[model samples]
Target: MHSHTNLIAVLLLTVLIHEGSAIWCYRCTSATPGCGETFNWRGIGYLGEHCPEPDDICVKLTERRGGSETITRDCLSALNFRKDIPADKYEGCRPAAKDERLAHYVNHTIKEHDVRRDYFTDTTFCFCFLDHRCNGASGMQVSAVMALLTVAAALLLR
Candidate 1:
């Protein structure tokens, strides 16, 4: 009986560790959009690279694109192109809208990684275990193991 009880406790502890580790991994290394907000990458390569956080890829790109002169020009162009900003939004000298070019620059800046979905899967796995349905069978293996332990305990106690 004592041995069976110990077995059950061990199984439960294993389950707890698995679930906790999955949740922790989901939050820590995952490169989800919300996770990207934790840093100030300025939404440049947020959807791409899977580095730690607040990567300076965008900063480097801006520096390479004619530095301050190009950045200020792009900002002025964006203000002019924005239909809702009104003509009064800019001081003078309207530059052509370079939205397409900016988008191309941003997209080409970073190599994409698939880390976000992996973390999402980890989170889903955590939820499944918590709800007692780890693999769509409703924790049948767990239940079976517990039942076997119970029966064995009863026999031993008898």
Candidate 2:
């Protein structure tokens, strides 16, 4: 009975923690270690820091050309998009707009090729709002652990 009770408490705590706040998302650039084109999820809490403010979403911008790639991770609110979409309330990735893609190619000295042929460069923007308190192996957020422990302690005392 006691073990089952503990399990139930833990489950409740997990849910509460998952929905507590935005989340401690990893913010970094390709320049930062482990945050390159191919991300290392294990480095989630090992580097970078939290978003400037809470309640914001996480964003990953990747610009690719031929064989070169650049990646950046930051809060969604911190981005400045030329054209806006329904990003504020949803989570997903989208390709850059036509004008934006043309601008990117022009600025980078690349050419946006024909649809049937090879495109020199492309830009993809990804956004997400994580609700996981403890995603095993991917690294757990500190605040989540603390909240879980606190709630467990309170439950034990009561």
Best by lDDT: 2
Residue range 2-31, candidate 2, lDDT tens digits: 766777788789788756655655667777
Off by over 4 Å in 2: 41-45, 80-89, 98-120, 131-158
Report how far off residue 2 is in candidate 2 (Å).
4.3
lDDT of 2 at 154: 65
Cα lDDT of model 2 overall?
0.59
The digit string of per-residue lDDT tens for model 1 on 1-158 reads 77768777876897776555421111112132322213222323332222132211111101112222111111222123332222332222232222233333333323354222121111111111232222222234666787798778767765
CA lDDT of 96 in candidate 1?
29
RMSD of each: 20.1, 7.7
* Superposition TM-score, candidate 1 onto the true structure: 0.19
